[model samples]
Target chain A: MGISAVKYLLVFVVSVLLQVLFCNNILIARVIAPFIYILFIVLLPFDTPRSLLLFLSLALGLTIDVFTNTPGVHASACLIIGFLRPVILNLITSRETLESVAAPRVKTMGFHWFVTYTIFMVVIHHFFLFFIEAFTFEGFLLTLLRIVLSSVLSIALILLSQYLIFRK
Target chain B: MKNLFKLIYRYHVVFLFVLLETLSLSMVVTFNNYQRAAFFDSGNFLSGTLFEKFSSFAQIFEFKQVNIKMAEENAVLRSALQEMLLKSNHGTYHSSDSIYLPRIARDSSQKAVYRFTTARVINNSVNQQHNFITINKGRHDGIKPDMGVISNGQVVGLVTNVSENFSTVISLLNSKWKISAKIKRNDYFGSLSWDGKDYRRVQLNEMPYHVPVQNGDTVVTTGYSSSFPEGIIIGTISDFSIGSGSNFYKIEVMLAADFKNLVIVGLIENKQLNEIKHLESLNKYGN
Candidate 1:
């Protein structure tokens, strides 16, 4: 474990703190929820094994749920995305293109493609996450509206963070 | 078995990711439905103490703003106090046993002494049909359900529920609010309820169209019940109109309290509330 190991740990701790404090505090109408914390999973080292990716995603979701008090909504969504990421990445990018890349970045995937990919994954995750969190159809329409609204918000935040911090 | 273990060990990253993702999703679902983890909230004495340490530092920055606002408010209140004293000197008043104004520096002849204990409003919601105020005081602080709550000497609402360290109040302007009140000057009394249109106004019902009511008349609680201690200020008559083909006059009241900037409050314990409630319910249930 060298400087790289320490840097990764620092990044993980800081991301969690920021997610809890800043992102969650901006609950627009108490509906739109930002899961930009998923950016951690989304940026995992390329060639990271599928099962490890799933496990880390699960850990990330559970940590958030523990803090915020919304239980399994995030954990389950992260699993499905983790399992499908390989397929989705393959569908969007060729084997040769991903081979040269270490992680998902605007530079590797190209800006428009990266944004589109993020919007899709974040929206899918939020839809299942919110639907399960609501846990009822009494206000089914309201739940859908919340999902759509939060997805847009979370995607915007993720895109902005990526644009600001990571050129690639 | 040895080969399988080796293969899983070799691909541990994939396994780790899957396990972590599954764990995270479960937390979200359980939290939403069961709220199991909420029991472990920072309310634990240990974490609470830690947060309290942080709050002391935070309060340093907040105190200046609060004190400055209070000082400016004190100046405005002084003028209002003078006006009230002048009005009372005109000798137009009613004597009630419930409202005990102990501090009458101007007139040493003050009657019943109403004591006030201030509490902070930590959370409030005006969007609900039955709006509620979460005050930071609770059973530890002598707050109980059915007690009267007031701000600036006027009725705000009644205490409805109490947690160990928190209590919820049903504000008067809520649509679900219905409190018995009467005209302070006369025997005419009615129920006050809000129609949810304005935060400043409420509707008075059941007053017969012939009560000789007029605009700017003072309205106070009849105190016919134990929820309030008789004659707590409710509001003043703002406007009145006769409903189409109805036997009652639809009346609007401008509440006597400025509800939005509530900082200090008083929770009144009638001391006899439970006994009164027991008697009233006995009549209905015959138990």
Candidate 2:
């Protein structure tokens, strides 16, 4: 348990660093900003306490907010997803499957299940983030376009990391 | 009371979620107001140092482009200097001696109006509706809020927040930031603001339709605000049209500065800003 806790802490730091140094810099098409830092919250062990998950989400989101200069947008989005993670997990996986699997990774949960979970989570995150950043529905279509494009990029990166780093 | 406590305990996660969201959303609202300097920004110590460190590595890839732009700016300055020397020797009357003189000489003749210092952009974003640029200079470097920032002889942004070692600039691409601008051909002025649609294009509002504005006509700063001096090149008129039944023309300007490739920027500190503001306040009270 002690080693596992240290490992999770390492993942948190790595995710935030990767996001601030690498992911934030890649603004494809001038609108899409890939946010893969949510991987820390998304891939947390399913048996993790609900309160612990929410707190961790707040920390992760606030860190990204500081780097990007968007104070509360990422925080609010992360909170919503963190609170809903279990409900979404319950919707997707059976009781026995979740009890056996330690966390939601491509290696443990299989490709299809993990992809669906990531898509749902990333979409919720980016949608809330972009709209809150906009703060208005003035150019509703344009904001929606940005959310879609950014989510596609973020989802792709999150899935790729599962294979490349979390395979073991 | 016991039942209430039990109910709270039963849904404590939901309550915690709501409380946290409220805190975050309030932060968003306060930040949007533009004057409340929130501490949760990249300009703070830890993140600012982190951005500066990583940006140094990333900027290595952009050095070639930065070098080329600097050389071009140097060439322009050199030609302007040559012209000034030629005119001075000819005894020709130059309307503005202060423009060509150094700060020491200018201060001897008249109060220094503006002082400039350059800084490297450690972080910048162009896509967001409320975009900000972070620079390496801050309070220790004499950077303060409300100072104007320019790059490549064009408007880049205005300083909004200053920390110990870094400052955050409100980018021109931000929809909330508006600057006073005028047409070069005619003295007609208007408020220039971004539409959150394009980074390269901004809208110049309140220009009466009767003014003969044409495509390619240069738009420059009005000098009405202390943030910028008179006649800084903002952009050229791209496309314009008047909405039906409206007296003003909707002028679209293509910004001169390519914000995406910004590396170095000049900050303009208005020395007379406080004095002017002080006098204005006194006049209001005196009346």
Candidate 3:
């Protein structure tokens, strides 16, 4: 694997481990549990193959599910965000940038584009995850609270980590 | 075949998305414990009513068998009652005597702790994020909010809303509903809540780490809430673990009631619920 590919692999393993071990336990107000594992999917190279992206996201989600004992909840939500990653990236950046950008990060996409991209993907992922986890709209407000809080925490963590690790 | 192959290759990305989503969703619905329950949650009023009608119709065909079973049970109950009457007439009966009776029958003179009202589930949904069961009996039938609903002998859900002739139940499979449950063996109680992925399993939270919970141990409602009676079977413990730096065990319970095939259910009316709520509300204001 190339250096960047190796780095991506390392990021995947580290993100999944951190999510399973630490982030899963950090429940603020018994609602906001930060799911930083989606960071790996968020950070994949912009031009990653659609099929490969889907498969990798499935593996990542299922792995998290195995650790958390939630079976397919994570996998389902992650697959959705993964499939939409390209679309979200396309919408936020120009064709030239999309072709040239190696991976989505604060430095590469600039702060504005990167923030918007992260917010879209994180919101979609969290919305799907919490709704599927609850499986009903009866507690619309509670589910919304969980989605918003978790997305904020996940986005903050993703952005902070990007700055700390990928900053030039 | 060539044209089909071309079409498949052309929209391969969309096809793959569909395939992966299908796989993931099926795994979620099939493997998780609550989706199956959601299937019969009675949230979808039309389909739920149709299902209830169909099941009840099917039940009519088995009435002969049911009557036989009921007759046999009644015979056994009569013999048991005869023995009790004999003991009492012989002046050998004591209030503390250990004669096994259903919990509802223990208090001879006092009002029943639980009054069961049979209701047919009219609508249900298990595939959704939040599931509710609509039952036929409602305010007209004296059904009220917070009543516990059950099928067969297993805990089902709680009555959350009631209309003049209909009521909605918050299924146990719903993530919003939580019940106080305990291990049948040790009386170690915890909060049982659905994870929304499975219809067959739920999570028991706040179980102390010291409790030696084992797989397959029975979990039952703790009767801490007026919603459900004490000792109603919820499920069996399927798995459990203590997370690092946590003092509680995270337990997975396999629900006992098959939510996929819910038909006739009983709504439990707690006679003392209003009084308890009134007293508790008074205490809340420190009055």
Candidate 4:
């Protein structure tokens, strides 16, 4: 348990640093910027306590917010995802599968399952985040395009990281 | 009490979700409503220090490009100065000796209007609807809210929040910010705003359709506000059109400063801003 705590702590710090320093600066076509820090929330243990999951997600979002100069937009998006993760997981796979797997990953779960799970979570999170950040429906088609492009890029980065680093 | 305990236990997750979401939404509302005086942002100490450290390391890579631009700009300024000197006193400037010319550029009649402090860009974002820039200077460096920030002689943003060693600038690309600007050719002023679509192109509104704007016409600050001085180059007109049934021209201006490569910026401190504001307030109530 202690080792696990230290490992997760390391993940938290590394993701936050990678996000603010690296990912935030990648403005592809002046619209698509990958947000990979959400992978931390996506990769949390399946059996994480609901309250703990919500708290961790909020803390993670707030940390990104503090760095990016958006106060509550990210926090709100992350909180919604944290709340809905269990429901989404149940819809995707059986309760028994969730109980058997220690955590959701490409190695533990099949590639198809991991891809499906990540797409759903990332799409939902980006939708809420970008819309809230915009705060208005003006030029909404452009905003939707931004959300879609950013989500695809974010999911690609998350998957790439999983393959390169988390393959044990 | 047993039944009540069971109800509370069963609905605990829902209660928690509502509580947390409320907190988050309230924060969003508060932050959006109040762009100035931010506390939980990069301008705060911990993130500010982290970004500053990171930028110090990152700025090394841009040294070559920055040096080239600086040299070119210096050459242009030197020629402009020479022309001004020659025009002011035709025969008196016989020799190009350093001692004959006046040391201070401002004569006694021209009081110093603006003072500039150089600051480094530690953090910046342009893709977002509400883009902000963080600089490694703050209240200690005489930077206050509403001070205009320029880079490479082009308008960049306005300072909105300041800490002891860091400040956040509301980038010109932010949809919420608007600055008064005018065409350099005809001097017809309009309100310039970002449309949250593109960082390079900003919308110049309230320009009457009869103004006869053309592509590549230079736009500059109007000097109507204390934030910016008159004739600071904003951008040149890139595209323009008249919307159906609208009396005004929808102008698209390509910004002069490249926000993507922002490294160093100058913060302009207006010496008479307080006096101007105070007098304006007096006229409000007819006192």
Tens digits of per-residue lDDT, candidate 3, A30-137, equal: 567788898889888878999999999999988776444355788999999989988887787889988887787777678988889889999999999988876668
Q: How many clashes in each candidate?
A: 45, 0, 26, 0
On residues A31-121, what C-alpha lDDT tens digit does candidate 1 reach at each position? 4556677777666666876776676666676665444434565567777777777877888878987788777887666788888788768
lDDT of 3 at A147: 86
Q: Which has the higher DockQ value, candidate number 1 or candidate number 2?
A: 2
For this target, which candidate reaches the highest lDDT against the unseen true structure? 2
Per-residue lDDT of candidate 1, residues B138-199 (tens digit): 77887777788987558988876665665667788566568898988896889999765466
> Which candidate would rank higher by lDDT, 2 or 3?
2
Candidate number 2, chain A TM-score: 0.96
Give the alpha carbon lDDT tens digit for every residue of B125-243 in model 2. 87678788999999999998999999876999999999988999989988888999999988799999998888889999999978998999999998788788877899999999987
DockQ of each: 0.27, 0.70, 0.14, 0.77
How well is each residue in A1-168 modelled by candidate 4, as lDDT tens digits? Answer: 898888788888878998899998888887897788888888888999898889998999999989887888889999989998998899999989999988888998988999999999999999989888988887788889988999999989989988887664
TM-score of chain A of 1: 0.88
**Candidate 2 segments whose C-alpha is farther than 4 A from its true place:** B36-38, B82-109, B282-287
DockQ for the candidate 2 complex?
0.70
Q: What is the lDDT of residue A135 in candidate 2?
A: 93
How would you class the docking of model 3?
A: incorrect
Query: Candidate 3 regions off by >4 Å?
Result: A166-168, B34-287
Please give, for residues B1-287, the per-residue lDDT of candidate 4 as tens digits: 99999998998887898899899889888777437436676899999999999988887898898788778756864785676567664323323322122223323445455666778899999868888999999889778888999987799999988999999999998888899999999999999999877889999999998898999999999888788877788999999999889999999999999999888787777767887899899998984
Model 3 chain B: weakest 10-residue lDDT segment is: B35-44
Candidate 1: segments with Cα more than 4 A from true spot: A29-33, A163-168, B1-39, B42-65, B68-287
